[model samples]
Target: MGNAEIIAGIKIPDSQMAKAVTELVRDTETDLLYNHSRRVFLFGAITGERKRLKYDPELLYVGTMFHDMGLFDSYASETERFEVDGANTARNFLKSYDIPERDVDDVWDSIALHTTPGIPQHKRPTVALVTAGVEMDVLGIAYHDFSDKEREEVCACHPRGLRFKHAILSAFCYGTIRKPGSTFGNVKADVLERMDPTYKRENFTEIIMGSAWDS
Candidate 1:
């Protein structure tokens, strides 16, 4: 494997494992998601560099690439949060390659917590960067941190299609719509709320009041 594609000064890892995961994701996910995952890796790596963080690029690459696996039908689980589905899928794949448990755990955490806000940023570098990359690409959080050239370069390579905002939201809705309970407290609840008018958000206050424990 050759380091053939470099975006924003970060070289795409060419390790055998890297190539394997890349091939898996590209084959399994739609172009919208495949390209988004690649952009996540590039943006994550760039952020890691800017922060002067000491991290393994290969591990981060794997994490970013697999972070959205749960959103696809092949990996989606009936009774789990989409994030957990993705984490478990990545865990299984890495364990197959006999990756060390510690590294495997990091990748698991990265995918599981990418949609979570506040917490991941405090975890390991790989974990934090996964969420950072997602936020940057999806919500445009910290959009100004990257230079115009960097943004253009990454998008030029991955090309966040003409209607990325709506398309991604649709993807999210499609993935989790069947398992609405899984979105109880997470951000996907918002996706369901927007896409499904019939979606009834689980109200925290109502749950507490309905609980058997009486004050």
Candidate 2:
């Protein structure tokens, strides 16, 4: 049987999967991975909000977090094809949520295609929204500074700062890509206007990236 089939056979309810996700996120000690997921959520949510995409913020948030849940799956360690395993695991877990077919597909596709570069570019607004979210997620993984254990420990206690860091990190990571027809051009502007209401984009980028630990 496929991993997805096995996961589907598990009796965990949607509510319980949600609880499991929440607890996993809460206890995750890997700051880098946690922050990367947070940025993907913020980026996806903001893009969806600005474009009026039909995706529910709560759904996007959960999917992004659990999109990578399979990394911890036994499959990731056993098989070389972790992305496929991750996608299957996500689809199975989401099915427990009774999530719509379309949204489930979206989340699955995002997880599946995130690491593979050079796929044919998509042009749909919703596709673009997800693509940008996933791209920013990769950028965060490739570039973010997660070395300041003290800051991460401190920010963990300050949920507000953590939230701000999440948003800012998303902006810093994916804010520069002007993908064809991308709405990100205005995204940074919106976040800055909404988050700071005063600073220019250059200042925002400089300040946030400067303060983030690079090593």
Candidate 3:
């Protein structure tokens, strides 16, 4: 028999396989990352509540938990961006449970586009909330949306390591530098630039000008 998902210590209700997914995330990610993922979920759920958006909380939890799994060696790929890898992992996890394809797709989009700005918010509530949650944790975007008490509560539960920004940035670099080509045409390219000084992404203007159709 498969191991039962744990929930005694978790603050959130273990809906469906959310506890299992959360446990997997904690096991796979570094402490800093795991805490960050948990905080993202809190921030996102709060935002969803504030906006009065109707969404599946468990789906959001699953998406946020797996959002950064691509950074871990077991899940990271040389060809795909970390986001895609994470999305694929989340998708597969959901499929194994015989989840509805539409719900699975929502989780996939949420994990894949968590880093993307402007677009995810236009997507479904699940996707949009994931992006908002991630942005709140990493960039502190819309930080004011939640009160000090709310922020303190989440942070208290998932203490931020000292120098969290630097640590997370370094983690991002570590995942992308070895696979520099995968960083091109996306936000991950900037991470490659900061970490590997010798790395340079292709210029879109040059590509457009050099295209055969330009003549």
Candidate 4:
């Protein structure tokens, strides 16, 4: 078991299941995704610690590991959104270990809603933390929450490459493009918009502008 202080007193989980999932992700996804998944757990744990939120480190680690699994062909669905696919995969994986149904659902929700803003925060502590971690890594949504040293430590381990933003976008498209309809009501829809010129999504900005109450 390998553990490191991702933040002051917080250590990354390195149990057998953690190692197995890490290896599974590494073997299935590219370096960009492998590193991103690991960082998601680290960052989520950091936020959970900072907020003094009660959480299960091992379960959170599992959720984060499988959060993006749907992006790979092994788990991808031609109809369901990758998020749901990933969430279902996590649920199925944890069941194999006889994880309690309650905890399994927590991990499932964590992966399913990691991409949806504002809602995960209202779910289980682990789910909110998982969402926080993804937003932090992908969008720098709360980058300032961590100290310079903490940020650097995480970056050192995960090392967001020079083209990370673009790479993540490309990765999202790779997963969802084959099933573009899967992105219909979520942010993943933006990937289809960018990947396919003719694919237009419902635009909130336009909706607000055209609303009868405004302008």
Candidate 5:
């Protein structure tokens, strides 16, 4: 019901759904995650603009906001990948609002595959941009691509805080430590290895050799 605020030349979606999502995330997630999510949306929108890709702003906003929800205690699922838990949470929330199946699927894919590197880049605009935003923010994958002004503005609105790298790593560790097996075959394995000395990674070759097939 209010004017949409523009960050880095991208308008934050001000729809009812957007407001509801913002409120829910702000209440449920830590300040770190809530701010990170907002930055992700802003960065992703900036990337989409640079790439000249057509995407739904509202869907992208939802995907970015919910992408890390799985890392929270309330949404974390036992035995499921954090990414999948987040995706499922977003999917359910969207369905409750009667979002179209295709749009919901895009948002779900965006969240589920945000942690996976190679594929999301080839998907639809929203899915691809979600990963783009995350990589830019966390991994610094395209850090220089965004100008100093752009980065400063986005971070000014949602400051990464004094120890974002350490804080985010700790967040990842805390979120997945309870379900260590869920970190296999993904980047979170590195997180666990770095944070938990007792954690051992699952080797793909060993798994293959240990399979039931006798050939």
Candidate 6:
């Protein structure tokens, strides 16, 4: 059997795979988005376990971890395209990394249709399960405080912390949850450009006020 086949048949070591993906995403200049993506992967894995998906847990984890790998390309390009290009990027990267075809398609489909919203109704059950978890992750991004046990709205590791607040603020500011065909590139550069280190905490509100990322 090939390397990809070996990876597919066994459980992937989380730290090892996560390190590689983290490096790849960090280099792409989407560190915070990458962090959130990792959380989505974790959430997806747990949801898959709970839902009894027949697929390998490792496959679900790895696939979801790299779902937004193409976000970098989308960010760099001028067209704001994501689905098709993101899938192509995933295909190429997985092929280069020797990922198995079935597992590859699993990730590709999930990434391609992630922002499509309505596409979930027709997706594979596992995809739908993962999607819901990812959505919750997005929803919990900036607003949910994990500390208040009695609140009962959302849950996360460090709710109400800086990371939690940043994510929540990001989701409210950068989230594109239900809208379809919303490309990050199509967004005005002035918006995301302001998200740079120079921007103040309150600047997110101004920058994202009328942007598609807020959709």
Against the hidden reference, what TM-scores do the models get?
0.97, 0.48, 0.92, 0.89, 0.97, 0.56
lDDT of 3 by residue, 1-215 (tens): 13433221224647558768977888899999999988888888888888989988888889888999998889988789899999999988887696889999999999988887889999998899999989998898999878888888788878887799889899899878778887777888887788788998889899889999947
Higher-lDDT candidate among 4 and 5? 5
Clashing pairs in 5: none
Query: Lowest summed lDDT over 10 consecutive residues: which window, candidate 2?
Result: 3-12
Q: Model 5 segments beyond 4 Å from truth?
A: none
Tell me model 6's lDDT, rounded to 2 decimals: 0.50
Model 2, residue 32: what's the lDDT?
55
Weakest lDDT window of 10 consecutive positions for candidate 6 = 1-10
Model 2 CA deviation exceeding 4 Å by range: 1-19, 27-29, 73-77, 117-128, 140-215
Q: What's the CA RMSD of model 2 in angstroms? A: 15.8
Candidate 4 TM-score, true structure as reference: 0.89
Question: Number of the top candidate by lDDT?
Answer: 5
Model 3 TM-score, all chains together: 0.92
**What is the lDDT of every predicted structure here?**
0.92, 0.49, 0.85, 0.86, 0.95, 0.50
How well does model 2 score by local distance difference test? 0.49
Give the range of the ten consecutive residues with the poorest summed lDDT in model 3: 1-10
Total clashes, candidate 5?
A: 0
Ranking by TM-score: 5, 1, 3, 4, 6, 2
User: Residue by residue across 1-215, what tens digits does model 6's lDDT show?
Assistant: 23331111233334455456556655763555555655565555545554566655554554556555544544323333445455666566666566667767777777667655667536765456446546656654322422243222223421334576455445423433222234343331333344444432324466678677847
lDDT digits (tens) for residues 69-188 of candidate 5: 999889988899999999999998887787889999999999999999899999999999999999999999899999999999999999999999999999999999999999889999
| Candidate 5: residue 129 Cα off by (Å) | 0.4
Error of 4 at 50 (Å): 0.6
Runs of candidate 1 with Cα error greater than 4 angstroms are 1-3
